[model samples]
Target: MFKNILLLLCMTALSTPAFAQDHAAQNADIAPDMPAKFTVNTDKFDFIRRDVMIPMRDGAKLHTVILIPKSAHNAPILLTRTPYNATLMTSKAESGTMRSVLQGYDNMPDVIADGGYIRVVQDVRGKYGSEGQYVMNRPLRGALNHTKVDHSTDTWDTIEWLVHNLPQSNEKVGIIGVSYDGYTSLTALINPHPALKVSVPMNPMVDGWMGDDWFHNGAFREEMLSYIYNQDATAKKTAIWWGNQYDNYDLFLNSISAGALGKERGMEQIGFFRQLLAHPAYDSWWQQQAMDHVLADLPLKVPTLLVHSLWDQEDNYGAIALYYALKQKQADQPNLWLAMGPWNHGGEIKEASTLGPIKLPSDTGLYFRKKILEPFLAHYLKDDAVALPQRVSAYRSGSDDWETREALPARDCTTDCTTLHLTAKYQLAMNGSAETSGSVSYLSDPAHPVPYVQRPVITRGAANSAWDNWLSTDQRNAASRPDVATFTSPVLTQPVSLDGQPLVHLTATTSGTDGDFVVKLIDVYPDEVPEQRELGGYQLMVSSDILRGRYRKSFEHPEAIPANQAQLYQFRLPIMNHTFLPGHRIMVQVQSSWFPLYDRNPQTYVSSIFTAPPEAYKPATITIDTAKSWLTVHTADVATP
Candidate 1:
């Protein structure tokens, strides 16, 4: 269950601060009550007088760690409901054990205690101390034996109990959390108690679709996230799933082929890990779990501040898609303001001062507490003079600069869509508006396929790992191999903005009835300078994805190709917020294998995505449809609002 994700590991120490007094500074200010110094009641603060048991309507009980502020005055309450074991939330269940030194506890207790608020942490149902059978996705249904409860239902019930029992200010409650807890924050809003007025879902789950933690267009994430239900506490009933859940992943690695499991590579996996082999197509199994379809089921009456990471190695992309989708829905009632940074899953980016070679003034976390949580809580709950405003800032890895936009990126366009003909001789060019054509070829061997860059080195589960950079490396580097094909673009004299996802159209013939088409979007940088850091000091990998040649026509059910017969394939990759500068270059690398990243295509039409034994994979060439194949990207002009 230990995944090495990039969740806000960013570390921005109090170094030289940015002096550019921008608008973020104007409206996004700290509370006047911020103390120059503070005190932590180490004993009372650290001690959980008792392990409180919370009950849900479904006859289920939840285990919680309640930390009361030293103040006897009934003030507002701040709660964080997490799945990462209640013990890790705040203070220390026991020191020098799982955590080093209460992880900046002084900062946490200082913030909440200073406000005279009670902080509580609960192990989500089916995880850690909480009781309930542990299902990774935690199917909307409770467990096989326990009371059934869903996220929305659980929070609604949880708040109902807190308002009456806690001595806090009458029913006035504030909820804040990140990742799974972030999702809980938003989930609370949909079916919230009257006391739930202000909430923040930081880098929350939008739903599993194009941006879900895993399975981007049927592509499985290589790393597996283990459902290590170390402990489960429910209604005084408890169950712990024994040992390390992830270590046995190998036993099920091939389970996809046996029609015995579901992909659990990322958040999307959380919803349907059990059906990985069953639902190769976006059938009812996946569609039902898709949160986008269920937002209508939400009662989003509370004011909300949504936060996501721009370079989050995990759920940000999906959350971004959700933000735009909700904005377009015209249901702005929640005033659902959004904030995006360059952080990761668990604030990893915030703790990391550098991204590869780029040394940030501070990990994106510097402004996290000050610019986001603090101002948000002040404006909504405390009615402070300074309120937080809607923010849309993207950190460009190349320039080490942050660009602010008035609004989110709704849509954009490309200046041109050019087709390059890949002759046998390796020539490249943009065909005229009329029609241009050429071709390239490479072999895809199931036996020796391309591996997911991060799989072997790191555990292949969890969508937000620091290892995500593995997905974006230059494809050209892959082209040097005999099995992969590479295509280059003429150096541009002007900047090219690829602000949205791109579509690749290819015409090809497979040696067998099935195969796959892999396309990578690469940013070829400029000539390197010695001291200034290399052109690719960032190795800024943009995006890459694979498409089952058979599913090129429909995602529902795929149709295999006629052996030795040529065919056309089309696939779309995730969107981007980028501007390829004048001096830079663009390169597209195409491959057949993305490794454990996606199940290997058997090169034979089968019912599942991974329908093969290691030996069943045959070497086949992906003949490029030169005259017919083309890559198109959506570009935008820099005309600021």
Candidate 2:
């Protein structure tokens, strides 16, 4: 078992390496020199790096890497804890602790190169070199028990140990991380050590059900299944690489079954996968896993900087939801601030200014790091008073400029509610006449689920580059599908800007007992678009969401819908800061399934969707009542682009 775990860890390195496939030459048998280039300038710097096992409160030792610059006079400490290996190399190259130690500082961001600080990175319990069992987004403990310790205690112990043991320490410490690492950074804030003065939890995993990793508004995230298991030894004996299949949609539909995933694929061996299978609904188990309750109750001991991307695939709702939760506690003068951009996942920290073909207004990642992140850390940790961003600093997609606000959603921004009715003629009209009342219907067959993206996709996990840019990819591929119902507004004569979330209300009836409704708000480019651009007639999905019919009334208690009965289902899509320019058209697409992106809804009600049999899958005709079904959008009159 030990040998198998180590083999898995060494094989499936940090999710998917952005370098692996790109450098794989057409005829070359050997892979490229990736490990050497992962972290550059290591030889030029006098930073002394060491690997150590730090004992936690429970006597379990966590594998940690400490790097202190030899030229440092007195420096502050910055710590990041990650489930991904603390060192750089991909899993294929990770041989042993000795190999990683010899590699020196690899895969760290360039900002650290201008270091006047002590940097530390560590693997959480049960991951990589750390000892003890691993738990996904472990729940916060109420009080410390002698028998057990949570992530909070582990963090406090690590910080306490670092402050005392490390020389040339100024005692002040800061924390920051992205994705899973971001979760650890956020966890460190719960009863934080006195020396921990500042933090930036960028794109943290806040909740599983609400719009992060696993589930989105009760809809199962199918792509994450292969992601979670392959990345960790807790789930699989070794990483399962589904080689570059020409058509991923067909690959998933024909190969994987949500009901039989555990029985057929041996997913039962994975602890968290077992727990996910057991709890289909948002029950006590999921509630206990939620971080919102814990975040709202936290004392504002350290000033926090919440960084997020407007298009973050993994944790889009995390930073926003956390901002709202933190605001509830600090209504008077909040210490929490937000910096949002059009980056993917942790792209705000990377050098990428463009996602796919959509170019950002400016170098958002660099601006945030220099103007917001660095200033915030320096001010709190090093007593450096620099002009840092205040309250909210968000990038406006259409305008291509950063907008600062006193609060998120902008305090002074007035919303003009516009309703686009789902018309009988397969059109989205701003105003509907009495005679235009009719229904539009489509057959939603479970055997042929709708594909979320164009097929032949080479990537697998959400951590990969492809998954990061899928949110803004052109939706024209799925638009022509018979299963997808697209309603479009005539080309616009004036510009329309949206600053907040959109609400999708539908009065619909299905042929089966259960179904999923996917709503997408799109901006259609003009026909005479530039050749090099994202293009004319490009359908960019600005905001989208899915609602499981059974959970319409309550997420905790799901009830099957009455077949052929008109039921009103409504849910808010993720927020956006996009503007539909003149000569563009607004489109609303309604569909039953998003394919492998989300697990196919059985359409027939069962005890649990995860355990439903193959026979339960059926075809269903969904009809949208024209008069009652309309998408409500929040638009602002501001025309400054």
Give the winner by lDDT: 2
Off by over 4 Å in 1: 1-50, 71-76, 91-117, 139-148, 225-274, 296-299, 331-334, 411-436, 454-456, 460-469, 472-477, 527-529, 532-539, 563-568, 639-641
The residue-by-residue lDDT of candidate 1 on 296-376, one tens digit each, is 456557777777665555564555666666666764445666665545454531455654434566666655556656676
**Winning model by TM-score:** 2
Kindly list the per-residue Cα lDDT of model 2 for residues 1-641, writing each as its tens digit.
99999989877785457457655554377766667657544564466667899999878999898877777656898888877777552222233322233233222344453647777888888887789777777677743223467788888999999988887778888888888878888888888899998888888888888788988888888778776666653522255745345555765676546646544567677777887787778887777666766778867777888887877777787887777777767765456888888888888777767765866656877888787787778887775666667778877786677778877653222356667788888788875532448998999999988878776553565344367688888899888999888988887887878777777879999999999999999988888777545476788888888988899999999999999999999888877888788898989999999978888898999888887778888999999897798877667546566
What C-alpha lDDT does candidate 2 achieve relative to the native structure? 0.77
Regions of candidate 2 where Cα sits further than 4 Å from its true position = 1-44, 89-108, 142-147, 234-238, 241-246, 410-415, 431-436, 459-465, 531-534, 637-639
Alpha carbon deviation, residue 462, candidate 2 (Å): 10
Instruction: Score every model by TM-score.
Output: 0.76, 0.87
Clashing pairs in 2: 13-91, 246-456
Count of clashes, each model: 48, 2
Per-residue lDDT for 415 in model 2?
Answer: 55
- How well does candidate 2 score on lDDT at residue 5? 98
